[model samples]
Target: MKAWQATPPFGFDALRLIDLPRPTPGPRQVLIKVQAAALNYRDLEMATGTYQGQPQQAFTLLSDGAGQVVEVGAAVTRFSPGERVIGCFWQGWEAGRLSDSAALPLGGPLDGMLSEYVLLDERGVVPCPAHLSMEEAATLPCAALTAWQALVVEGQLKAGDWVLLQGTGGVSLFAFQFALLHGARVIVSSSQDDRLKRLAKLGATGLINYRSTAIWHEQVMAITDGYGVDHVLEVGGPRSFTQSLQSLHPSGQVNVIGYLGGHQGEINPLLILQRNARVRGISVGPRQSFESMNHAIEASGLRPMIDSMHDWLKLPGALAHLQSGRHFGKVVLRITAD
Candidate 1:
């Protein structure tokens, strides 16, 4: 098996491709021949040694992947050889509330799926939606599931509700799609007008060019007719948290999912108290949530919007693309031919 590993003192230049013996599955485990993988901002953090609890040794590079099952352990019954499956971001989190054991996520403390072959507990994988291709399914584990958890599971989004998405990244775009799937209207903000135009075509009822409108929450309030949005996907962390709180209607929720902007800033607790707002931090999600999301994707025929695809060996280039922040949607790595 071949995999990309980040050498100690992590950076893009530290990534190396090496050969190793293919891993065998243990009881209740499954072996996957990876067909595709996707990159996330966290991958960049891991590569640069900036992620919290950085690994002490080398590990595989990406958390999101889709592959075909080539073998299953004797005790495994949920999946079989030839089944298409996607690895969950938090392999140990099957359902219920998160625990200390569930904190070890893929692509960091644990070896991930950026290889030709990988092994996982049957509980760590979910069947991919029938309507999506391997590349699209590969995008679901992290970005898509985060959006699902933030909007559907946490926000309890409903028809005609207003959702404010911070930008047109993978998570935001997926949130936009899921909001529409639930018959909700979305307001998406981006620095680029072209991206905002594209978002509008994808069911964004309102758009804001944050580059021009520094205090974009005012735009959000105006779009909502002064009532404010029902939910805010707060991906910008400290840089946008204050406005995210201000843009909400009474009792609205803000699901903190990312820190794309700088992580340092001040937030006022008075805003939360005044609006009676609920601010929740979202990890990607449990496998159970991934399964429910798959059902929704299949039922609605929803497909992920892929920004671009690169060959498996082009992992470095893909990472660079993600780091550049110009991509409109998920940046994928085609690990194997379909």
Candidate 2:
């Protein structure tokens, strides 16, 4: 077996691949033959020692993966060998809270699925949608799940509502697809006009090239006939928070999911009062939400936007590409031979 491991402390250069013994399942545990894993921006933070709630050095390097069960423990009942599956980002939750016990999560505090095989409790694995390939299903556990939680759960977005998507990153792209699937008109913003055009072709109702029009909120207002958007998938850090508030109609909802732009900044407190908008910070989501979202995804036959796939031996190169921010969707690593 092979695994990607991070050396003591953390740094991008420190990530390396090495051979390890294959894992065996215990009671209620299943051993999976990992096929594909996707890279989140948080994976970069975990590599660089900057992520909040980062695990100790002994942990694995990725939190999202999908595979097929090759072995199951004696007491396992929900699953069996030969089932296709994906691991939940949060291992402790079967269907509830994001964090229940101090369990080691894959690729964080626990050994992740960056290897040929992995052992996880049955509760941590979900049946992968049969329609999706292993690579596409691998993109779901984190980025896609977060978008689903924000727009559907917390935002209470409904059919015919207007949604504001921040950029072309993993979460935003998933949000775009999910919003459109729910019958919402989506407005996507990107610094690149080309990307915005691509998003427009993908069913986005309106596109805002933020680099050209710095005040994207005004464009959002215009697109909605001055009513403003009903919900926002807030990916911007503090820099875009104020504009997100201004972009929403009174009593709208903003789900703050990421801060890739930069964290240190401030928002005008009066906007919340004046707009009567509700703002909530999201932490990806709980495992139960993941299950519900998976049901919707499977039924709708939604396919994840995969930017690229890398070989296991070139794992560092994959991380470097994500750091460059040159891709439009999820970057994945092929971990299994089959």
Best by lDDT: 1
Error of 2 at 130 (Å): 0.7
180-259 per-residue lDDT for model 1 (tens digits):
99999899999899999987777789999988999988999899999999999998889899999999999999999989
Candidate 1 Cα RMSD (Å) = 1.3
- Cα lDDT tens digits, model 2, 1-338, are 87888766679777877777887899999999999999999888888878887766655679899999999999999898889999998887665554555545678777887888889999888999889999999999889988998999877778999999998999999999999989999999998988988888889999998788988889999999999989998888898999999999899999988897798788888999999989988777777788889899889988999999998678888988999999889999888553
Q: Which stretches of candidate 2 lie over 4 Å from their true place?
A: 99-104
Residue pairs with colliding backbones in model 2 are: none
Worst ten-residue run, lDDT, model 1?
A: 95-104
Clashes of 1: 0
- Report how far residue 152 has shifted in candidate 1, in Å: 0.5
Q: Give the TM-score of candidate 1.
A: 0.98
Choose the strongest candidate by TM-score.
1
Q: Rate the local accuracy (lDDT) of all candidates.
A: 0.91, 0.87
